[model samples]
Target: MHKRLSELAFGESGTVRYILASRHELNCLGVRVGKHLTMITRQPIKGPVVVAVDGMEVAMGLETAGCVSVEVD
Candidate 1:
């Protein structure tokens, strides 16, 4: 199903399909179309969402996470 990064549960995974943010920010994190990512942890109450991207851990804000679209099994 198509879902936002924020909607993914911890330990779940998805390929990044779209990011509604600046290209610089996107490239800095290596986020792009078809990039695989796993949800490591989602902070409670408007916190960041930690995701594992190619063995790298990155924290994304709730707002940014909401704009990231992903396809999941």
Candidate 2:
């Protein structure tokens, strides 16, 4: 199913479908379409969301995560 990156549960993984914003910035962080991503951690109270992409962990804010679209695996 397609969902926002921020909606992914802890330990869940997915393939990135598309990004709604910050394309350049996110790409620099190794987040791009077709990349496999695993939700490593999600901080509470609207905190950052940490995801593993291509063996590297990247931390992004909740708002940014909300703009990332992914296909659950």
Candidate 3:
């Protein structure tokens, strides 16, 4: 099912299916189609979302996270 990355709960795993941001910028952070990620945590007050991508933890702002579509696994 397609859902925003920010909508994923902690410890939930998902595969990146789409990116709505600048591809180059998202790519720099290792976000791309077919990449699997796991939600680690989200800071309070609409803060950044921390996700595990390719064995590395990546911090993405709520806006950016909302732009990423994922398929929950």
Candidate 4:
């Protein structure tokens, strides 16, 4: 099912469909909606995740997580 980034949890896997925001939001955080990102691992509470993007671990924040929309892969 399609869900927002904020809805994702640890051990959850999905794909980046597209971002739904203005250019301001993009500039504020150097992230594009269509960017391919996968959750590697997360913290106990709310924190950044070790997302596998282009074979790199990009630490993303809880807020930024909303930028990525993913589906079960």
Candidate 5:
């Protein structure tokens, strides 16, 4: 199933399908389409969401995470 990255539960993993905004910035952070990502951490109260991509972990704001579409494994 495809869902917003921010909607992923902890430890859930998926491949990126698309991004609704900040493509350039997200790409620079290794979050481009087709990349596999795992939800590492999601802070409470509208905090940032951390995702693991490649061998690195990238944290993005909730709004940004909500813009990322991922195909769940």
Candidate 6:
């Protein structure tokens, strides 16, 4: 299944298949579909978990929990 990168859980890993953000935002972030990512853990020592994209870390919001669609290997 395909899902947004923002919906994955901590320790959850998956490849980005697509992003529905605005074109301007997409270009600014340099993110695109098919990018592989892995959720490391929540950040701020109490905030949302962190995800890795090409070695870069990104944090996910708690409200958007069901945004990413991942496939387990």
Expressed as tens digits, the lDDT of each residue in 23-65 for candidate 2 is 9989999999999999999999999999999899999999999
Report model 3's TM-score to 2 decimal places.
Answer: 0.94
Please, what are the lDDT tens digits per residue for candidate 1 over residues 9-71?
989999988888665676698777789999999999899989998899989888888889999
lDDT by residue (tens digit), candidate 5, 1-73: 9999999999999999999988998999999999999999999999999999998999999999999999999
- Every candidate's lDDT: 0.87, 0.97, 0.91, 0.62, 0.96, 0.54
- Report the C-alpha displacement of residue 52, candidate 5, in angstroms: 0.4
User: TM-scores across all candidates?
Assistant: 0.91, 0.98, 0.94, 0.61, 0.98, 0.54
Per-residue CA lDDT of model 3 for 19-68, tens digit only, reads 99777778898888899999999889999999999999999899899999
Cα deviation of 24 in candidate 2 (Å)? 0.5
Residue-wise lDDT of candidate 6 within 1-73, one digit each (tens)?
Answer: 5544444556667765544445344434444556677877755534664667788876556333234444432
- Superposing all C-alpha atoms, what RMSD in Å does each candidate have to the true structure? 1.0, 0.5, 0.8, 3.4, 0.5, 3.8
On the 0 to 100 scale, the lDDT of residue 61 in model 4 is 66
The segments of candidate 2 whose C-alpha lies over 4 angstroms from its true place after superposition are none
Best by lDDT: 2
Better of 1 and 2 by TM-score: 2
Q: For model 3, where is the 10-residue window of minimal lDDT? A: 21-30
lDDT of 3: 0.91
lDDT, candidate 1, residue 51? 91
- In model 5, the number of clashes is 0
Error of 2 at 7 (Å): 0.3
Give the candidate order by descending lDDT.
2, 5, 3, 1, 4, 6
lDDT of 4 at 73: 65
